[model samples]
Target: MSWQQTTLGEIADIVSGSTPKSSVPRYWDGAVAWATPTDLSRLDGKHLYKTDRTITEAGLNECSARLLPPGSVLFSSRAPIGLVAINTTPMATNQGFKSFVPRPELNADYLYWWLRANRRQLEDLGNGATFKEVSKAIVSRVKFPLPPLTEQRRIAAILDKADAILRKREQALTLADDFLRSVFLEMFGDPGENPMNWDREPLSLQAEVKIGFPFKSAEYVEEGIRLCRGANTMPDRLEWSDTRYWPVSDAARFAEYALVSGDIILALDRPWISSGLKVAEVVQADLPALLVQRVARIRSSVPAEKPFVFQCLRHPSFWSYCNPTETTIPHISPVELKNYPMIKPPRELVAAFGMIAAKQSVLRQKVEQDAKDARQLFQSLSQRAFAGDL
Candidate 1:
């Protein structure tokens, strides 16, 4: 079968949205969901359950922002391009979005998947001196290869199944994280309670905590060391791609601060945003890597006890203690981290918690592996489908 290339305008109609006047009380709050690009980052799938802010019917009438029906593909065109989500609810978005309402003959899921696969092409079309943006005319003119409606639906179904499997694994990982947090809270009581009933120990006594080396941005290379930053530390994973690198000399200078077999790296800045800590084990070939200035190195005194500290840092009680006083950034300084109190249980009980954490870690590893496999499978399918080999 031969594939025909067509512009987005031939497949769908592009619509822009506007915000209602803020001064009008009736326009400020209502039942309509008002979305921004920031909201797209948190979604698990095409459907969006809620938004940070909502608007009233009066607001909808006051602005160009009209209610987008279910299945409309929403793309962030300004600030950043190609962040896409299909509207599951009757919603209106900010100016940052350029929504595409697909023609009835075209499948919405197919359009969403196709656009996502061709995101780089859309990004390349962005034109602006100050801020990169995809104008309606530019978006409408970008071409894409399309398959028959049935084949499009089939390809979408395959991709959807793969995505669903990955999402389930992610959900399982989230549950395991919650379980670890619960274990920490149960082991250590509320902060207000006296430390007499529990063991009290300084972090210095429990682990080898070290500050990261300060390497200037000019020292960054294309590829050398796996440099970690505040943004690299995520909830359950460390994003290593698109990372800045360090020179061999600076990497050697920061070698001592390099992550060891059982070190937990915690971001001192913006700790509250992610409860900012990531506990990662150093795998083979990860040596000579250095932590960025915003992060700290935490090595447990005992190898068996490292996971316990990882769990402790994620506890809500820890955040409660850290959030009381505001700093320049939402962070816990090194002094604050060192002085922060912890309700220590008996060593045997701590060991038991570590055992449970270790088990959770194994389960999480399996889930992650499954998710990775699903992603690879989806990528392969996408290539084959687009090439008419599927």
Candidate 2:
């Protein structure tokens, strides 16, 4: 394969975006589609066709915003740079973008993939006082490895197929989540309506809800006892990649806050995300860790009832009962979570359901593995494609 060394400026016209005046009533919500970095970040696919806001023709003329024709490769430059997408329709963006219009000799889809492959490099290039930003001059002057037009299209095609497989694997994981929720509904019925009417009890009576202590940052050490924070909690699992630690001597003073296996931890602040609640089950690997503030731990009095109680807190009904929308920052109060209505099922029934759930998890493990493999495969191909080995 032959390649040519060229700057982004030699093969593409760099375009900077601008926002319409917000105060002008006539400048808002019209025929022109207007987008921002937030809009690009929300996309699951490479192409963008819609935006949350629009602007009038008069607004477009009044502002620096220019209509980008279909096939333009858009890249966000500020307020978290490196979100890339290809436009399928005419669109304009806010100042948060430094987009590209490739020369006729260049394939737009190829450019989009290049942007995806170099996101980290672009992020590193961003420089600003308030928040990092990549100026138009910086982007235009960046090095670009150019291949033949035929080869560019072929490379894009291969990546598109790999991306499709990666997306399907993601869908499988999502389906696994749905399958678990369905099983919950089948065994217990609608938790909100308590259709079974077995009896209602506050969560506090069924389990112990312990709030995490406010460990002072000044006392933090380089290693030893790990501090489990609200940020560590994820849906159904815990992520300890970014962790803080305390000295071994510090553990003796915070014995009560020490975490153990089977304890369910929930975030007290912004407890829910697009994926679901910020709750996780503590496994043996997470033990010997001390809890941090803005987190709560729940443990059942009867070990047999553990699975049932965990399901109840994660149920859609319980989420609705919390109604996090009432406040500016969505949250769940300890009192509110403890008082969440739970159905009283027989101990034998709960135990039987737990057995079934454990069996189902075996199948979910396969789906999770497949998803991980798909991610690795895509990453490898992306590296090869841009390196001219595809």
How many pairs of residues collide in each model?
A: 0, 0
Clashing residue pairs in candidate 2 are none
Candidate with best TM-score: 1
The all-Cα superposition gives candidate 2 an RMSD in Å to the true structure of 3.2
Q: Which segments of candidate 1 are over 4 A away from where they belong?
A: 49-52, 120-132, 190-199, 247-253, 272-288, 324-331
lDDT tens string, model 1, 42-129?
7768767678889999998899997888889889898788888988788999888889898866788988888777888889989899
lDDT score of residue 200 within candidate 1: 68
Candidate 2 matches the true fold with a TM-score of 0.85
Report the Cα lDDT for residue 338, model 2. 91
Best by lDDT: 2
Candidate 1 weakest lDDT stretch, 10 residues: 274-283
